[model samples]
Target: MSSLLEITWTDPVTSRKGYVVIDTLVRGLASGGLRLRDGCTLDEVRGLAQGMTRKESLVYDPADRYLPLGGGKGGIDIDPGDPEAPEVLRRFLAAVRPIVKEQWNTGEDFGLRQETLDKVAADLGLASTVEAVFAILPDADAARQRLAEAFAVNVDGLCLADLVGGYGVAQACLVTAERMGLDHERVTAVVQGFGSIGGAVARYLAAAGVRVIAVADRDGLIRNDAGLDVELLLGARDGLGVIDRAVLRPGDRTGPREAWLDVPCDLLVPAAMSYVITEADTSRITARVVVEGANMPTLPEAEAALVTRGIPVVPDFLANVMTNAWWWWIVFGDIEPTAASSYSKIDSTMRRLVEAVSVEADRTGRTLRACALQLARRNAEAVTERAGVTG
Candidate 1:
């Protein structure tokens, strides 16, 4: 699908590039996340926007009040660790303020954080990063309050807002395990990336009896034959998702970052940057399944190679749909802003989605992504029809 609109801006001061892609629109609004990374490109942001459309459609339910909005994404090319990162982000946000105010609702992704986005948005005098959706909400004030309350709810020392997406990713892993007839306790996982999504996925999978044997961050890889201490590592992570080397346990093994795909495990989750797994890298994959915890983490050729090897891959849109859906579920009154309620809803919904995708894939003898895209497109059409829009 072609994007409805695309913008590329070059920063005046640093000449850095920033991009926005509004892939589709429903009720005059679209939603996705803004990412900051050293090598971010317009094409990457465009693909992410398309993924957001699929994610929004895959979560659609006629019974729910949260009608899925279309997909949009923003990206800026600057290392988040750079000293000038804040100013670059400020200028990028300022450059796109009009779009944010009118139609695009974006939050943090990849190298970006929610607090940083919020601060910048506020600095630009915007009411909220997602204020665009408020225009269509029945009661904007109530939604604002409810969303704030939901974000404030803490679970197990981590914010509920941060845990929801990774919780869904873990749920997808568990569901996939059940379908493959594997014992969850004996299954091992190797997760690439230790950021919010990766950290949370590791935590929840560990809690569910899965032994996460290896986890890779930007610095290097941490491995333990038995199982790494997920809680300790999660607490030790910095804002950029890098773990402190001082926190390594006596039994833990450290290796080069390039060795992530070499680790033998039952499930492999790439939760880091996009396209890390190339066609050549697929040769080293020993996992039975590849669950994408990051958006567009695997290249098409790599996925095709995995398919030839009979490794099932759970697409990113379905696996990591929780965070985006959670916000809408709360804002649209389909769910209350409480931990119990949110957890219950997310679990049931994610389980249903995973099962649906698996069954469809088996029935049609197709890749999981193909079946999922079919489902998403059908639902998207229905959603568009219901919204009285044509695209």
Candidate 2:
């Protein structure tokens, strides 16, 4: 029989409920984020937890023999955007504080913030010793503040990965261009999200001399043959990463929000949300390369259609896991001897991971998704074996 999946938590204060899905726990503990969104469901949490397990395995493979830490995730189905949402969150945390103190580690996810996490930690009297994926909180109150600060830091650093992933994508595109004997100078790109990752990618690609002909966000799409000023667009971008509609001058304006998809380009990156490239949109994509910057931005069917068209796709799970790995190392205090050395280590690791995926895909004639899964499974199996001996 398979091991039973266990998810347990409660609201001691208000009797409201939350849950922790422990996907695997071979290492000393499991780790994942806490999401508070209205549409979050138990099944969704379980799937995400499983993905976390896979991500951990993929990143830590063939390194030090760290047992699988197990994948864990928790969430509350609440509208975090609501005005009185803070109070609701407080109650939710009051009920689950004890659980957070004990076995299940939680961090911020979508629709959740550090300020609110800090408040929850304070209410539960969780000590500062409790660490999230980013930093260590010295006490409950400090943890609360740290959570907030960590979140701020995450948002602030959003621009950092912009160049990192963009550079990687550009490098990948360059490689693909070389292999296909395509003209690199003529390559144009469209960024389908103006958020940090999307905007950063656009900037980095433009800097590398790739013409970013189009960019879009929640409000609208902007296009210019001469290329839009990435820095200026970023300056005008709002907190939610949406570009202000007022900035879209008549010359820069596209027909509608969906016009971004139809913009002819050599590369198209969906960095905004999941399932953006659905079946209906797949027929319209003209890009030769698609790099996913968001988590699961393309549905399986859409991905298949792209594959059928011979369009190379860089898988989202492979491309985005580096950020999580970096945060994990920082939170775990697993830095190198020197600060500069540590930063270099992280960069090297990310580059190597991306290269490895690309190489494996080429070698085996398999998709990046297949290669990443194979790598993850190999590591997970090893972790599972170690757990059997140790547990």
Displacement of the residue 2 alpha carbon in candidate 1, Å: 2.1
Highest TM-score model number: 1
Predicted structure with the largest lDDT when compared to the true one:
1
Give me the runs in candidate 2 sitting further than 4 Å from their true place.
1-20, 36-38, 61-68, 76-80, 113-123, 127-186, 248-251, 334-343, 384-391
What is the Å distance of residue 339 in model 2 from its true position?
Answer: 9.5
Tens-place lDDT per residue, model 1, 1-391, is 6799999999999999999999999888999999988989999999999999999999998999999998999999999999988999999899899999999998989888898899989999997899999988879999999999998999988888888888889999999999999999999999999988999999999999999999999999999989999999998999888999898999999999989999999999998889999999999999999999999999998999999999988999989989899999999889999989998998899888888889999998999999899989999989988999733
Looking at candidate 1, the ten consecutive residues that score lowest on lDDT are 382-391
Clashes of 1: 0
Segments of candidate 1 deviating more than 4 angstroms = none
Give the count of colliding residue pairs in each prediction.
0, 8
Task: Write down the RMSD of all candidates, one decimal each.
Answer: 0.9, 5.2
